[model samples]
Target: MRNMLKATTLERKFPLLAVENGCIISKDADITVAFRVELPELFTVTSAEYETIHSAWYKAVKVLPDYSIVHKQDFFIKENYQPDTERDELSFLSRSFERHFNERPFLNHYCYLFLTKATRERSRRQSDFSTLCRGRIVPQEIADKEAAAKFIEAVGQFERIMNDSGFVTLTRLAASEITGQDGKAGIIEKYFSLSQTDTTCLKDIGLYPEEMRVGDDILCLHTLSDVEDLPGKVGTDCRFEKLSTDRSDCRLSFAAPVGVLLSCNHVYNQFIFIDDHAENLKNFEQTARNMQSLSRYSRANQVNKEWIDEYLNEAHSKGLISVRCHCNVMAWSNDREELKRIRNDVGSQLALMECKPRHNTTDTPTLFWAGIPGNEADFPAEESFYTFLGQALCLFVEETNYKSSLSPFGIKMVDRVSGRPLHIDISDLPMKKGITTNRNKFILGPSGSGKSFFTNHMVRQYYEQGAHVLLVDTGNSYLGLSQLIHNRTHGEDGIYFTYTNENPIAFNPFYVEDGVFDIEKKESIKTLILTLWKRDDEAPKRSEEVALSNAVSAYIELIGKDRSVTPCFNTFYEFVRDDYRRQLEQKNVREKDFDIDNFLNVLEPYYRGGEYDYLLNSDKELDLLHKRFIVFELDNIKDHKILFPVTTIIIMEAFINKMRKLKGIRKLILIEEAWL
Candidate 1:
């Protein structure tokens, strides 16, 4: 990790000699020197461990004068070096380079080791730098106070961007803050100041309070590098030692600047100049205002989706991190409180991908649809979409349950952080189902709640329009309507009825099985099936009917091997008889002893389980049934032992079969009194 912070400057050699207490160390100075020093906690100003640090400063010298050594260490230099800005130039340097160069250590393995050494050095020099007083630099260390003040002012002119408000990610902003030209130059000058003793002793040059006028408040802090390692030892502690709102410890120094201490205290502080003009504060406020404005929208919409793209693209280009988008759809219940809960929970996690009301009409209750960004791991997973929608749905439901008087048909993008609504529509494209001429309507209610009445009403209305109608009645309740419609209009040719008691409808292998078959027939069946399944199989039908149909289909697929043969009640009954006989023969049980009802009970599971799979699995076979929505029509069958389950099995199998055949039929399926 430490190596990740290596300097980009190529080596431009400068000749120098190491001196300890004014004595030269080594005569041969050809090699690059490494300095190891302790660093304050990241984003803080102090290292927990380490009194003084050790550094081997490398300034290339042609010859060295023999000198007593205070501290010495070996280091390696790449044979060739030049002073150009390239990472490779300092890639091989150790902690010593960071200390000598006075730059942030590279974030990599090498830099880690360098930080460790630097912290150790800081521990050793705790006493020496601690005694230095504020407003006083090490004597004879600097030339002009005004130049330093001007430089500090220039540094303060650099602005820090507000990351939370816009499309920018925190990590990207951090990298920018570290490497931008202004940031880099400030670091260099700060290091230069730290290297001078006179500059280091200046009280204002050390860590200055944010507001000097405060009687007991450390509002801010600044650190000059001259106060950090002025004695030329990486281990020397030249940091601000005492901190209180009171300026009582003006003379004491610690291992790190007061800015770092404030940082550790969770108080925002930076090593910038004190400008009474408040220009920096104004800029900060302006940037914040800009963010607030950009983040708001008239509706809950994605914040500058285009801007997000640009930000993510730039971040990726810089080899930073990843970004993604998420979308979800959720239905609302009558209870409004549930809706609000969903909104509160999920609306905060994402930039609203989309906000669609649950209901689009005044009479209908509202619902919600959300689209937001998700982590890369979440993309393409059905559950991810469900999670987003489910949570949001809960909130929307809760809100409606608690507060229903609000206008219902509104769409907006939501800011995840502030929960503010962005009213603009971010997703400009409208969702489309498909193109078709069929009319579809939903008649939803609990059992015995006039669902059939609603459906019959629609059928009557449509039939009166002179349009052809095919009544696929899964429930016998429709038989009365069929007769009524047929008798009312000698438009008898315009209506057709299919039920268990009625004539068997021919199965069309493909919706176009008969070249002239009306397209509306296929479309109606598809729409019906879509609705039934959308309700999660609560459609009314005898479980036995479903079983019988599946058993027949299963036996045909297993034996005659012609799945194309649509199994009716008789075919299924015969297949079950044969299979029962075979099983009895194998067990040596007399067929006379077998009870038909008991045997059927034994066979139900297979039909329900594996047969269901087969029915759903055969798309080609289902294509034949697309035009005919196979309704079990259970009203005439009084013996539920033979009727209910059987009807269910038949409808289920037929649905699976037709579903296999059906592709984009815009289908709706109805099951009246569906629960068993």
Candidate 2:
């Protein structure tokens, strides 16, 4: 059987005729046009985005019924380095210092699309003659211009669909050219060269093997009985296993056995051949009829009783449904030891998943067949080859459900399930223009849920993107993050404000710069004062509230007229005590009716020599808007009766003022223990 299989698997090579814009024409006049697609950067893609991408592909295939589409994704490992080495050198003591501290491995992804046009009968006959005569391929131009135009239009439609979801696609220019030692030649040479082994040559037009030595491995599906329930989404169900013994200090986590190959550590290459739906349906109908006939014959003759009964029962249990698809899974590695390890690991994973896989011993023909179009004879199908078709095609590797934000500002974190570093963008959420909504986000979780850790990580990313971030917390959760950013920016970026009774961080709400006291600021100040003075279920009388508002308005006007006068809590208190009372007397309003003495007593603690006097009287020391990151630690003041809410209100008002001042700059205000 092996000898027969070998004889039947003759290695046939095709010559390349000419390379033109957008398409690669083979000697047999088969035109395969290729385009490169850029996958969106996202932590998890939303369901809507997924449906849109899927529908786009479906529509494209539906429009071009005669053309065959091949979608390919290639993932490779790239060593991480400082993005700007010169900038790093200026900051570091030496180049070696920077490399020693900041180098790691991350996965780089690339996606490509190939559309092959249907062959003409005349071209096919001529190609068969040329092959028999051992002559060059006859040059033939693509005859159907309308079909080509339609293909381009379909791609444009897809781009528009993706763009709405924040994904952009561009045409990969000269996709048919190969880059190597010879420096850019027709891709046909790499595929048709007789001197080199087929495994060493590049077969695909858009793909070039630069990082890893050019080679391929043929992974055949030996068993699928274990795949009784395929997941609705595409990705492996693997957990992260600790790679080091010291869990406390070690930061390495790798996927358990099988997942390592599919994740970023190793790359999995897939080539899927989708059969015609109409033909597949026809074959399934015929198979169903044959089964019915066999069942009737078995019951009538009682032949192989037990086997026949099991077959009939199985057929009755599951409805007749099947899909025709041929998939070739391959993994490439430059090192021989690594390749062997990957092959063994892949087999083990398949077994673990209950779907057995066999490494093809006839590597040359199998790998060659994977890249060639309309060549399915190399790998024959078995009875269990067909599967229940899914609504959406699976890419094997789980990707982010939605596209990443358009801005190139994010950090890569390891995905808990796949153990692949996923890019999490924290710059800004992409929303349609004219939409009115709050961008504030809340993180709620039980203890040890990594809420603080996640916030610190996100804040760090925002700072890296040049956004000003202010974090107010009761615990010292951000101290470590602050120090890290401070060191990286050479003590020029991050600032920490720790508020304690003995050494309180001063913030005068009434202190405003000249020309900066807009009505919004004044309103925010009044709101803060009201929050401080008004008790729950104890509303201040309307007259007293009006008096306070008039005092605040008069004080703001006073400060605006005279730039030298600094308005603090004392200034407002004096104005309410003397000027406000005198005006009320003139209006014939009695002091006893307004309860003026109580309002003065409620506000006296925030004045001179009061317990909270330091906060309301002192000048502001930190510029919240200028610094990249500022953290106000309220650990010492969290339990105070009056200070907690007052400090929080002050901080909130200050941040609001800063945001108002910096209109064009993006700012983030994160409040931990916001309920307090």
Candidate 3:
């Protein structure tokens, strides 16, 4: 059954020779060192920071030798989230959070950089020939070891330049990572197999006129090879509208549209070819003259010459390095129908970048062949256009997905883009790092803008993490959360208080736990009495103030001495009106200054038989220091002149008591609608 036609595998015509010490040596003697790059998290960088990152790249790329290729490849693979449900201390809400994103899919990214030194002949090669087009090519030997050593030193400097910037880091890939070993796939294998894992086996690559397919997965290539497809202006970063506001802005890298937004299995390939700077500028100058000579014959020539002149003027004026650049998004899917949809996604993503997407079917095989780890020297020269180094570096995707905080004390938050759960330590670690001096946060937003929603989520998790949380809110924002905790603890916590016509919020001003009346407690009782007795225009006289202070001290001693007597505002009111009134008369206090009858008349509404007797005669003890979660719902009485200030004073007393006693546990107090 032998046929006369010849058949060969990709391995026989493969351009790579061997991988040594994490460096790849190619058949054309190209030496490439690979590194795994770590960039800043997405949505965290500002516009000014983006420019700094671009400048860092400029300094890093300038150190490389002439004719070297800088290939930065970003891989975004669609991966389904697998929740970890085995943690022992997970609360009910935490467990539910795990289930909510059980099978959610997100685009996981991995970035790698390859710095290659190519031969002059290989750098000038065209798309007409490649290892896949011709027969086997013999590997060449490097005669000058000193030049290679110098390049390695320069690469070390390149790595130093990037790491010193504080925004990006580069880790050199190990030998085991560059070439597969011990059942683990390497970068080269992942590129050929189009898989994010080590389990995928090599597939057949079919190069047809209509499409390019690797195994059952069909490839979709979109390239920005021509300058006509580029926008008129470029910048370091662009504005993100989803999370931006008129008062504030959120910035992402300029190439972000084709980055995480594309949402598929794709590789963004960025190439920078470092040619001799002076020689390249001279060549452009000569081409500009040629265009000028043909301007009389065609108006198009005149416009082309002006453009070339502008490019030359900028390069000379700024001392810019002219380099060739090419970018492509190579996506693949096993389903042909899905491949068509991915093609459209890729095109639209490029359009978002203000670029025209060119589906290059004819050059698909060549571009794919050139993407292999050390084989970048075989890239077609015609596919790239010349631009300055600064302009080319702006197109890099300088962001990554969010990272979880390391501290144990934090709130559970969801990643906006991935829907994955994140533990953010906004309080503890921030204080340690000096990012914040204290954990006091002020949230401001218009109504219905999720301000209350986010605060509710934060306080709930904080309570679960053993924090004492007290909230004073005018709206019923924490009702559901409070109810959940209340039921979970079987009414042991999550205490909420609200005022209504049928039932009003009441407190015991004369009650103090542990049978201790300190100076602060005595002062609070005096303040309460003054507020009840004095009008807005009336100021208490000196004699009346001393009389009220004496009344509070006498009642505190009575409660301490007599255990059978229940301590409450009613008992204190009775003591001040009866027992203290006779003592005040025995001391012969002036009637006009003390005004006992007038005080009783003003406070009669809060006495035992008064209309508002329930306002201060509660027996609940209000031991808020022992309670871990408590909320005071003040919406019903926030506008009432009598109740709002009284309720606020009582709430502040409870919080101050808890803060003074519980020193070890974390505490949070959120005040909602506090304007009133």
Candidate 4:
């Protein structure tokens, strides 16, 4: 046993030495600066915007010095939603909403970028010389302090270039986040254990020729290491047909198939090794000459020479920098059956990108070691294919999963790919962040396309968060939700009124909760009466308009003085019939100028015992202001001239009144399929 070829442990071959001041130092004189990458949400960026992100990456990578390694590692781990049910302030629907998502599994993604400056000797090392294969560790001295300083400065510039694009943001990782504390695992520890959570305990790692295993989970890796396996022509973005139509194209990054679209617990590692441009060109030129010399032996050699010449010509003419690039997807599952399914899923996803998936078996350990946050210098060069910076950047995914809004006000939405519930703020947060100009939203779809369904979902959440929601829907789309709220509040809120022969929708325009009539309130009341009395084509006479305004003013004044008299259309009609007629007679107004009898008869339907006598005298006026969810369903009477216009005016007046009383509160008025 002692003679078993000097058994070496992972601790002896680990490439990283220590983390200091938020930087990772390696055993081979490599220093890596780490950052957490925040990308735009999936399905949100357009084709032009994708080019901006790609250009940002291209420019950012151009700022780094020769022999620098840029490694972007994205972890898509399966996680469950942990709802906080302990909050006491949650409403009944809100608590149920939270519970509905509890334990719901989703692929949680976290992206990281590592900028590593490797020593010249280490930069040129091959796969056989990786730390995983070497038992004796030889530490390289980092003698050039100025080079490290310059590299850090260049990294800072790289960050600025990416951030200034306004689409991508990079945040520098803190020391604690890189190398965590007692209970939490750091970035390096997480890689070693293949754990998604920071609080996971370190587990044992087993490496075999067939696969790699971390505790109970077995790994499956698929790599795009050779140019022969990649797509013939790559671009900044591709058309995603799952969420796109022929008329409307949805654009995503070229490598999106292997990104958030690939569900499961996985990691995507992208590497671009920036070697000396002149040196790589010289080597390629030398290789092309060799291929030319061997052309007499085989036609393949002639073809290879032509390809190399084109590469050299493009590099020299276009001033394109030569870089070595590699990308691979690593997935794992605890059950063998699930691991097989994950392997198939990964392969199919790669196939979706028009690439032949190569199931990588060997070099798994070394590749995993190189992905250690700060140890990017230890990556195997043999696994990478040579490409230009622009083409290499095309393979980078520019989007991530939708993150929940931090603001308290938002609607509950599901992620398109993951189906994870996301707290999305389509109104306030977008306006606050300057992402949108206003809170106005316009939804367009054919029938049965869930247009009203989405609006119902939105308003329900709005109502739960102390918002006053006034819905004027022609159909009964909001009936169930309004009923839910109505039952939950026990008839105190969520008032839903639909026109029926037995019981019609009604409201009191004259009743204000606070009994204070501002100019706008009085004007709204006047507009309601005007809408009721005159037809759409018939314009009221000037004298009649003035007389109606005076009557409303007089009734408002009488109610302000006397608390016993109710402030509704009944009292106002009676005051106009008996008291106002006597006043008109005293003023001796002529019958042609002002007809009191005609005015009373026109508005008499809303009076005590007429056809719509129950319209304006509402006992529910006080609670209307406090009601958070109010739906006026006019499906039956939307075509009726009297009920439709009158009901809309009354509901709108109530909304206006609520807006005045509830000063800083949120109020939403959604009108769907009205007058349809």
Q: Where does candidate 3 stray beyond 4 Å?
A: 1-29, 41-44, 127-143, 164-166, 174-176, 180-184, 198-204, 207-210, 239-251, 285-310, 401-409, 412-438, 442-451, 516-520, 541-554, 574-604
Candidate 3: pairs in clash: none
List the global CA lDDT of all models. Answer: 0.28, 0.52, 0.87, 0.86
What is the RMSD, in Å, between candidate 3 and the native fold over all Cα?
A: 3.6
Best by TM-score: 4
Tens-digit per-residue lDDT, 1-676, candidate 4: 4564344567777777888778888888789999999999988899999988998999999999999999999998888888878999787777888899889888888999999998778877888888877877787788898989999999999999999999999999988888888888788888877765776576777777778888888888899899999998999999998779879999999999889989889999999999999999999999999999999999999999999999999999999999999999989889999988889999999998899999998878778777888878888888999999999998898899999999978888888777788888888898888878889878888998999878877887787687889988777888898888888778888788888887777777787767888987888888888898888998888988888888889889999999999888899999999988988899887888878888788888888889888888877665677778888888898788888888877787778777777898988888886334
* Error of model 4, residue 536, in angstroms: 1.9
Each candidate's number of clashing pairs is: 139, 8, 0, 0
**Candidate 3 residue lDDT tens string, 1-676:** 8775455787898899998867899988889999999999899899999999999999999999998999999999888878878998878778888888898888888999999998678888998878777776888898667878888999999999999998999999998898878789989889988877895478777787788888888889999888888888788999999899999999999999888878889999999999888889888889999999999999999999999999999998888889999899999899988988999999998888899888888899999999998999999999999998988897788998787888988887888887777889988887996778988998888989999999988998888889999999877888898898899889989899999888899888777777787787788778877887886688888988988888888988888888877998778777878898999889898888788888888888888888879888887887777889999999888888777777777887788777777788888888987553
Q: Candidate 1: worst 10 consecutive residues by lDDT?
A: 365-374
lDDT of 1: 0.28
Question: Global lDDT for candidate 3?
Answer: 0.87
lDDT of 1 by residue, 301-382 (tens): 2344444344445444654222111222221222346544433433322112123222112111000000000001101111
Candidate 2, 560-667: lDDT as tens digits: 788667678877778778877787778887775676687788778787888677767766534455677888898887877677777777777767767778787778
Which pairs clash (backbone N, Cα, C closer than 3 Å) in model 4?
none
